[model samples]
Target chain A: MMDRRRGLGRYGLSLLRFWSVSLAAQMEYQLNLIIEVVASIATLAGGLFTLSLFYAHGQRLGGWSWEEALVVLGLSTFLDGFSSTLLRPNLGELVKQVQNGSLDFVLLKPIDSQFWVSLRNWSPWGMPEMALGFGLVLVGLVRSGARPGPGGVLAALLLWACGVAILYSLWFILAATSIWFVKVWNATEVLRSLVGVGRYPISAYPPALRLLFTAVVPIAFLTNVPAEALLGRTTPFWCAASAGLALVALICSRLLWRMALRHYTSASS
Target chain B: MNHQRSPAPEPTTRPLQRIPMRRSPLRIARTLLVSQYALMVEFRAEIVLWALSGVMPLLMYAVWSGAPAGAAAGVNPQQFARYFLAALVARQFTVVWVIYAFEEDNLLGRLSPLLLQPLPLAWRYWAAHLAEQATRLPLVAAMVLLFVAAVPAAAPPLDPMRLLLALLALHLGFCLNFLMQYAITMLCFWNERVSALERLQAIPQLFLSGLLAPLELFPEPLRAVALHTPFPAIIYLPAQLAAGGPIAIGPAFLNLFGWLALLLPLNLLLWRAGVRRYAALGA
Candidate 1:
């Protein structure tokens, strides 16, 4: 147990060092902060406008009220910001490293490869979007007048973490496939397009697409389920299922990374 | 006669000869198209992925068909399907990546060699885009056929005139989009990282371009404003025409022409100015 504690401490220190270096490198371009802020605000405004189009004539999308749907949109925006902050920068680098055969250097490091690959870089540009997303969620909750108790809030947070885990796993798995398909960069773009469907409630889609999003892509869990949890509308069964899915996805990503590493032939080869 | 004998001694100063190179516009365009098509065909896999990434319209169609807004807007699910399927095809052909491509070339110093060529540089990018669309043709057609077979309501009635007009609008929209993006791409000479600005531009395009939802569903004022922008001309006008929806063909075409007129000169002006600036920077 003591050894495990020391190992955790080591990893924690390494994460801090990695992020600080990345942050300093990124700070060289401070103008990106302003650009990111404006882009985030514009994106949110456009999203709100599009959402308002549905509710223009007192129309509800799949029986979801405007405020409830706002919660879903907020969650979607938060995940998109989360992706930009972590998944995009890190996984994008993973693709490049694989292409250039630099994964050899990463694997030879003392730390775990997955941990280093996943958390090597941090970009502050996504912070504005994340803050706006959380703000939107708060506004949605207040406007909807759904006061969740402490337990409810905890459950929502837990489920939201599960959503993030699932998202990270999905991204990592796709990035890992670069080991075999060297040009899988656009594969992530396809995923991003599909993830855009989460901007609306899953039920808003046709039944076939709803099934596809839920069963195939699990995008429904990423946004809708968390929003439902926050609204205190989700069942225990769904909560359990979400947790289970996150665990399975995380384990699958780890296993896939190991398998892919086995198949990795360096650029020299 | 003495010249022939002197050349035999040592052909020291050869007479210059005019090569008489015939570079008609038609020949240049054909050569560019053929070469670019050959290049694009080599990246068929990446192109397929790009085509798949354009499923936004189809997803929007699903949502609109199931949402109450279609009924409220007096558009049936069948009509929504047709419009979005048309949008998918229109977007496939009209997609522009000139900003990204140009930014890479400028940053990597690849533009210098291309600029030194006798042919105008813009024609190279233009021909590359056309060739990409040609390579994308079969995949997009297959997707359209599959969607139509699955949802027969998406298949519009056979109207050759409308088809021809839609085709014209599609190519025109492509030109307008390319010119607009290329104009912005000229900023690469001034800024190293201009693609981030492209993301900002995309937000307006996403909402206003009728990619997410049809313009008819937009509020009256919003729809009116959107019609004035070049965004709708890029997707909505052509898609609506192809879908046989209610749209003024003449006015839509005129809007496209007007934007084309405005952007064409703007792009040329930016190009000339940007090249001078680029050269001054010692690039």
Candidate 2:
């Protein structure tokens, strides 16, 4: 147990070091960072405005109160920021690497290829988006006046971790497909569009779609469960289901990555 | 002796004749159409992925349906679905990637050679737009038919004449959006971050163009303001027409053409200025 803990601690420190270097490099482009932050803020405001408009027209959406809906939006925005900043800059590179056969360098590294690829780059400019999302979550919590118990907070934390795992697995699956079909970048975009539905409450969709998002794609597990936990509406069963789904996704993506690596051919060939 | 030499020299060569067989704009357009069509076929998978990205409308449809019945003021679930379905099809035609394309071309110095060509740059952009839309038509049609067949209530009332008119409006909408985007993209010649401007513009386009919701659902003053702008001519008007909603076809077409006419001169002016600003660096 002590050895395992030390190993995990070393990995965490390395990731922290990678992020610091990446952040410093990104800070060199100060003007671009400022512009991106400003643009992201504007987009956030626009999204909030659209949400308010819906509330103005309808008192509730998908049985969700306005504050609850805001919570879901906040969670979605936070996850989106996390993915774009970390997973996107790195895993998104997998496509180009596969196309150019530069992925051989990644595979040759002593570190885990998936771990290295996922932590290779970071966009500090996206930090503002995460900040704004956290702000929204606070606003929603304050407005809703929902105070979660200790267990609820713990459950929310666990579910949030599961959301992250599921996202990483999904992204890995997308990147893995490029090994077979070199031109699958657009497929990733389609996946983004599909996952984007999580910005709204799952109940907002039709019955059939709700099932698909919940079970097939499991997008509802990403944001809804976290938000619901914060609202003290999460059931133990739902929490377990989310964790189970994340485990399944992780195993499936691991298998896919191994299979795909076998098909990879260096550009020299 | 000099006069005899000059006469012999004059007899040695025939005068050259110039042929006036320059390609008409029509012929150039045709050639561009065919070439772009072939290119689009090569990128058919990408085009399909692009079409599949139009899920926002479907999401809104779900939200509208889930909203309390008659929750969207006066718009019912069926009307909402019909409107969004129409918007989806219209969007496949009106979507423009000029900003990104221009940014890349300008940054990479590819626009220099294109400028040397006798044909105007707009023709190339137009051909690309036409090709993408043409390639996307079948997919859009399949999606629409599937939705309508599955959810019969989502089907919009259609008369042959009205459908024809709506198609015309949709085409004009595409032109209006393309012109506006082309004009916006000209900023890349002077600015490296035209994407910021595009995102800023998207705020208004989303709110005013009825992408988020129907314009009628907007509060009275906002609705009036949105109607006055050219944004509605892009997606909302065509959607309204497709849904067989109350719309003045004549006035709508006039609104669309007016926007197009205004944008044409602005586009030309910007293009000239942008070309002048293009340093022709690395050429």
Candidate 3:
């Protein structure tokens, strides 16, 4: 218990530092950064328009109504956009760092390498995502005419938080694998492509993809199940299940991260 | 004396540029292709990886097409396949690396070297991009041919004239895409991380550009909007030709040529502005 508490604190500090550097980078390019922001806004708007078009064909997809799917798609985009701006760019550097033996510099720091790698930077152009997600939720709530009482709201927030936690944990574990194998760029792609399938509601997937998203990658737990709860369609099983899945994902990723650390032969001797 | 007596009766007519030893265009094309093939050997893995961008949307196509007759979106089952598959093949054929090359040159500070060359910079840039395309085109064409041969029955009837038009249309489509992306990339002179700006546009271009789904499937005003937009012609028009549709070939070419006319000059203006900004910043 003592060891776990210390480890968690260090991880929190690393995440804070990462976001700081990323925000600073965005500030440096203040002018065209506006275009980046607007471009992202245009894209999210276009995505929402696509979903609306589909919904025009039918009142519901599978079982969820238009707004419900919108909530899922909206949150999923927010999460993916968050990762793309903040994480994806950094990740493209991973193979280069390993190949060029630059990981040695990062390894020498007195920090958990996975924590450091994952939170090493923040890119704030993705800020629009949080606004977009919140906006979509508002739209869905207005359309559904169902206000989640405080209890429902609290549960949804907690679930969403846990969902992000699961996403972070999963990426850290996968990224740590680079320490063992340098050619895992495709592996990273496979993981992202796998997660992408989660943009739509998990239920729209056939049973196999559903299993893959939830069990194999557990990304659907990252967005869909939580969005479901907020839309007032969630069950106790979902809350318990996602919370439990979050715990399991965190534990497995942490263990994998540690094992990877023991094997982290710095790119240089 | 022998040259004067027998061979001197016929002196050859002068050719353009009056160069007696210049390489023929066909032979130059072949040499460029050979060199490109050799260079690609080193970057083979990257080419394969770049190729995967065409595959991910196939999954979405599968799911949407699976919907029962009436329940499907605006695209019927066959039209969806035709649109996505055409987009796939067209993408494979028309990819160019000009933007990447431009950004790389900017980053490495090597633009001066190219400017010093006697050749027209734009012609050299265009030539290098084409050299690469020439090598890749054969492989792409061969792949299509093999697939066609596999299913002789399903193969679109060979129409030589229309096929030539489609090839021309595809080349023009690549020219437009390259110019648009090149202009975006040249903005790197102002901001080094212009890839982010390009990426922010990715989601829109991926879906709305008629790659992942047809513009027709989009609801109401959007369907109308996308049809009018220049984005669809880049990938969709050429792809429809591959799937054996009777495209308004002349008008489509006119549309693409218009985009090139608009975008290339605008890009040049942006390059001028971006470079001035870079100089002011002491780059």
Across all models, the iRMS values in order are 0.9, 2.3, 3.4
lDDT of 1 by residue, A1-269 (tens): 13344578889988898999999999999989999999999999999999998898898898899999999989989988999999999999999999888999999987799999999999888889988989888889989899888988998998999999999999999999999988888999999998899999999988988899989999999999989989988889889999999999999999999999899888779
- TM-score attained by chain A of model 1: 0.97
lDDT of 3 by residue, B132-156 (tens): 5554565656655654464343354
> Local distance difference test, per candidate?
0.90, 0.82, 0.67
Question: What is the C-alpha lDDT profile of model 2 across B54-87, one tens digit per residue?
Answer: 8688778877767763464777777888888888
Task: For candidate 3, give the DockQ.
Answer: 0.21
- Runs of candidate 1 exceeding 4 Å displacement: A1-6, B1-17
In model 1, pairs of residues that clash are: none
Q: Which pairs of residues collide in model 3?
A: A22-A122
* Best of the two (1, 2) by TM-score: 1
Among all windows of ten consecutive residues in candidate 1 chain B, which has the lowest summed lDDT?
B1-10
**Candidate numbers sorted by DockQ from highest down:** 1, 2, 3
lDDT of 3 by residue, A1-269 (tens): 23344566767766776777778876877765677667767767776765665566565655677778777877777777667665666665666677778877888877766666666766666667767766877787678776788888889998998888787676666666777766556556666766666667776655666677777778778778878778777899889988888898889888886787687777665
Alpha-carbon shift of residue A257 in model 2 (angstroms): 1.5
Q: After superposition, how far is residue B125 of candidate 1 from its true place, in Å?
A: 0.8
- By TM-score, rank the candidates, best first: 1, 2, 3
